[model samples]
Structure formats: structure tokens, C-alpha cells
Target: MNLQTIGNAILIVLVIGWIGYRQTTWRPVAIGRMYRLALILAIVGAGLLVQQSHGLTGLDVAVLLVEIVISLGVGAWMGAIARFRPLDPPVRVGSSDQVARFASRTGWWGLALWLVVLAVRVGIDVLATSLGAHAATSTGIILLLIAANRVARTAVFAVRLERHAAVTA
Candidate 1:
């Protein structure tokens, strides 16, 4: 591989590492926090899309949407299986109620979904590149998939937590 390709490979590795680091640090999160994370991820995905060399073809967009759907489905299932606990009180003025979660290790499988998705992404990328495909073309799709997964997972956590609290109250 040339220097640029090598550099890109290194960047991808670093990004995966960063994502893994984030996953490991999960804890109780507030709604606002989760929303912000989702928003940020979405914006990043959009930015990546705009930077693409060619305008999105119908097939590209379609494939991206499909991937996003898959991401959301897996994310929701993963989120639903996670464990959550109330923060003693649902709310305290100016303090985080911790009802929403991006993702937490409190569940049975911990970061299984996150890790699995990440590994799958890397595998797909490697396979695509080996087949002489331009990987950058799919950057937007990849980012969107990541963003969608997090948002879906976060939404699931919020819904479940709210319902859980309601039932107990």
C-alpha cells in the first residue's frame, strides 16, 4: 500500500479504537446527553456524505438506507436487552436523572453488539477494498450506520426506562 493508503488504514484503526474506548466507558446517561450524542453522530455522518467524490447514486442511497435499517434493528434489540436502574429519584433539579443511555455494560452481554458491529464494519471494509472498490464512496454509509445504531439504541433505552419508571411509580 502507498503512504496515503497506509495513513488511511492507520486512521481507521484509530477510529475503531476510539469507538471501542467510548463503548467501554459507558455508564448512566441523561436524555440530553444521549440526544446530544445522537445529534453529533448524525452531523458527522452528514459531513462525511458531503465530502464524497460523487453525488449519491440511487443504489448507494438505497444500500445505505438498508444498512441503516439493519443498524436500527440490531441496536434496538441490543438496547432492549440491556439492564437499567433508576437513580434513586427520576429527577433532581439541575442534576442528571440518568434515564437515557447511549449504551451501557450493565446488561448480560455488555458491549457485544457494539463490538460485533464494529468488527463487521471492518470486515466489510476489508472485503470491499480487496475487491477493488473505492472505500471512500461508502464512508457516508458507514458513518450513518454507526450514527443510526447509537441513536436507535439510545431511543430504546429512553423508552424502556420511561416505561419501567412509570410501572414502578
Candidate 2:
């Protein structure tokens, strides 16, 4: 394979490995860790995407918007289905009352949902290759989608937690 292909493969591997690590566990993620993960994604995503941005057209922009909308919906769904639990006496990472309140839920449905969404992203790569649509930039688009999904998922979870917290308090 060419060097670009190899680079894309490496990037996808990192994405998969990161997501897989998150999926394989059912523990309350530290607030610090979540922020760090988001920052990492953002940095990696932007660094890689900048090189690919030159080829994008109006049509590509529209398609990317639609994809982002769909990804946000998927993320909201994932957050909704997560099983959230409040820690008694709260495990504080700081002085704040927000003691890393996160879902530690696990099961088949989450796995299925993640896999289906992932498959759709992979499908984008396949379509881009088949149609000869800026093949070099396709991986960047896919990686950005992954980053978007992660940030969106976290936002949705936090929002839901806020609403629940408001009710409980």
C-alpha cells in the first residue's frame, strides 16, 4: 500500500483502539480523563483534517453537515441509553459537587449501536474509494466524524445529567 494508505490505517487504528478501550469497560470515567480524551481527539482531528480541507467543496460541506447532524442524534441516543448512577458522598476530583457522575452501564445494545455507527463510517470510506472522491481526504473526514461523535456523546451525557441533577435537587 501507499504511504497515505498506511497513514490512514494508522489513524483509524488509533481511533478504534481508543473507542474500543472505552467500550470494553463499565466503570465511572474520571472527569479529568474525559476532558483529556476530548482534547486529544480535537488536537489529532484538527491536525489531520487541516491537510485534507483544501479539497473540500460546497457539496462536501453540505454532506458533512448532514453527517454531523446524524452523528449527534446517534450520540444523544447513546447517552440516553446509558445507565447513570449517583455516588453517595460523591467521589470528588475537586471541591465541586460534580463528583464524576457517569454511567457505568454495559450490555449487548450498546455494543450493537456502536458497531452499527462504526460500520456506517466505514461505508463512507468505501463509497469515497468507489466514486474516486478525494480518496486522500476521506480518512480525515472519517476521523473528524469520530471526534465529533465523541464530543457530542459527552455533551449529551452531561446535559442529561444536568437535567436529572436539577430534578433530584
Candidate 3:
């Protein structure tokens, strides 16, 4: 594989490892952090896309749209299935003074959903390659798909947290 492909593989592995660690633990729901990461990924992805867009075909764009939709759907499903509970005394997240009154964990179901996302992404990549949509398999597209997924999941968490706050207050 080329250097870009190898770098993409390494990045994916690291991200998957980090996500897997978070999935099994009851962690403070840091909505701000989630959004920030998503935004950063999106910005970087967009930059990469600009660098690569000249080579993209209409079919590549179509494949990307489909992958984005699937990513968002799976992310929302994972967020919906996550279990949330009140943090006993609440805890500060990151450097922000914003206290997290609730913690959430996804356990096995979230992991399974993530696996489904991975499978669907791989399947689409294969199909896209067969259809001559080379850009569909690019790192920029992969990052964008991941960003879309994270944004959807973060939105669900934010809405749920707001609802919970309303109910409690």
C-alpha cells in the first residue's frame, strides 16, 4: 500500500481503539468535547477533499452521499440505545467548568452497531471501487463519514441531556 493508505489504516486503528475503550465504560457525557472533535475532523476532511476533489466523478459523490446517510443513521441508533445514568455527585469534564450530571455507556450494543457501520462502509467501498468511484475510498471521504456519524450521535446526546435537565429542574 502507499504511504497515504498506510497512514489512513493507522488512523482508523487508533480511532477504533479509542472508541472501543470509551464504549464499555461509564463516562461523563462531554457534549462539547464530542462536538469539537467532530468539527475538527470535518475541517480536516474538508481540507483534504479540496485537495482531492479534482479527481472525483459523479459516481464518487453519490457513493459519499450514501455512506454519509448510513453513518448518520447508525450513529443515531447507537446513541438511542446507550444507557444513561445520573452521576452521583457530578463531575467536571475536560478543562470546562461545565459539570456533567449524567454519565452514559453503550456496552455491547454500541460496539455491535459500530461494527455494522464498519461493515457497511467496507461494503460500500468495495461496490464503489467496482463502479469506478475511486474517491469513495479516499481518506477524506472516510473522515467525513466518521465526522457525520459523530455529529449525529452528539446531537442525540445533547437532546437527551437537555430533556433530562428539563425533567429534573
Candidate 4:
């Protein structure tokens, strides 16, 4: 991808992430749900992965959508697991040791699983870039913009969910 597209993608992800982080508390249910939503955003990003690729035919979009659905299913399952699993020990001892420990334990697994999904998205993006003879065209730029909007909207929703949960908790 060219600098412009890359910058746009980065802006999108960061905005969404920031929104989620700002809206949510550090509670497990809220944070876990937010991460789950992040996974969905990543799947959307994956769909846009082939936007600039010449090799991506109509069949490719179908395949990408299938992949997105699969990813969402798996991500939801994993998020449920993270939410229900028993908390583990913290990596450090401190005043807020309980919270730290809980986060550390949960974060390890959550981050690991999310990283794997993210890796797939990155791989697809790279493949698309490689296949494209030119930099991101108008279609690709539009796709990226759409992905950005989706991600940002999802993040805002997640933040709202988090806030609601926090109020209840």
C-alpha cells in the first residue's frame, strides 16, 4: 500500500482503539467485549485487504467475506472464553496487584489470540499489495475509507457497551 492508504488505515485503527479505550473501564467483561469488537473490525479490514489487488476477482471477495464470517465466529467464541475463564496471577506485585494480576493473566491469552488473527489480516494485506501492479487505486482508497468508518463505529459502540457495563458493575 502507498503512504496515503497506509496512513488512512493507521488513522482508522488508532481512532477506533482510542475511542474504545476512552469509553471502557478496565473491567473484564467490558474490556473483553471491546476486544471482541476489535476482532470484528480486523475482519472488516481483511475484506479490504484485496481491494488493490489485480489478482482479486469476484471469487476473491466472496472468499474474503467467508473468511470474515469465520473469523467473527471464532473471535466471539474466544472472547467468551476470555470472559468466563478464571483469573490468574499477576506478573508483578503491587498496590493494585489484584487488578494487575487479573489483567496480566487475561491479557496474555487475549493478546495471543488477537495477534494470530491480526497476523492473518496483515498477511492478506501484504499479499494484496504484492499482487497489485500499482499502489492503492480509487477503489482501494474507498474500501479503506469504508473499513475505517466501520471500525470507528464499532469502537464507539463497544465503548458505549463498556460504559453501561461499568455503571452496572
Top-lDDT candidate index: 3
Candidate 2 overall lDDT versus native: 0.63
Against the true structure, candidate 1 reaches a TM-score of: 0.71
Better model by TM-score, 2 or 4? 2
Q: What tens-digit string does per-residue lDDT give for candidate 4 at 16-121?
A: 4553443232343234343445556556554655554556565455445544554554444343433322245423323333232133122345445544545565
Model 2 residue 8 CA deviation (Å) reads 2.8
Candidate 1 structure lDDT: 0.63
lDDT by residue for model 2 over 1-169, one digit each (tens)?
Answer: 7787787768767766656566656656454555556667667766766765666655566656666676667766766677776755546655445466554553455556667767775676566556555532456666667666767767767777778879988
The TM-score obtained by model 2 is: 0.74
Candidate 4's error at 49, in angstroms? 11
Off by more than 4 A, model 2: 29-36, 52-54, 92-98, 135-138
* Residues 14-73, model 1: lDDT tens digits: 766765565565465565676677778788778867775357555455555656777798
Candidate 3 lDDT by residue in tens digits, 62-115 = 998999999899888878888899988989998887788889988888877777
TM-scores of all predicted structures: 0.71, 0.74, 0.92, 0.41
Displacement of the residue 151 alpha carbon in candidate 4, Å: 12
Instruction: Work out how many backbone clashes candidate 3 has.
Output: 0
- On TM-score, who's better, 1 or 4? 1
> Clashing pairs in model 2?
none
lDDT of 4: 0.45
**Relative to the true structure, how large is the alpha-carbon lDDT of every model?**
0.63, 0.63, 0.85, 0.45
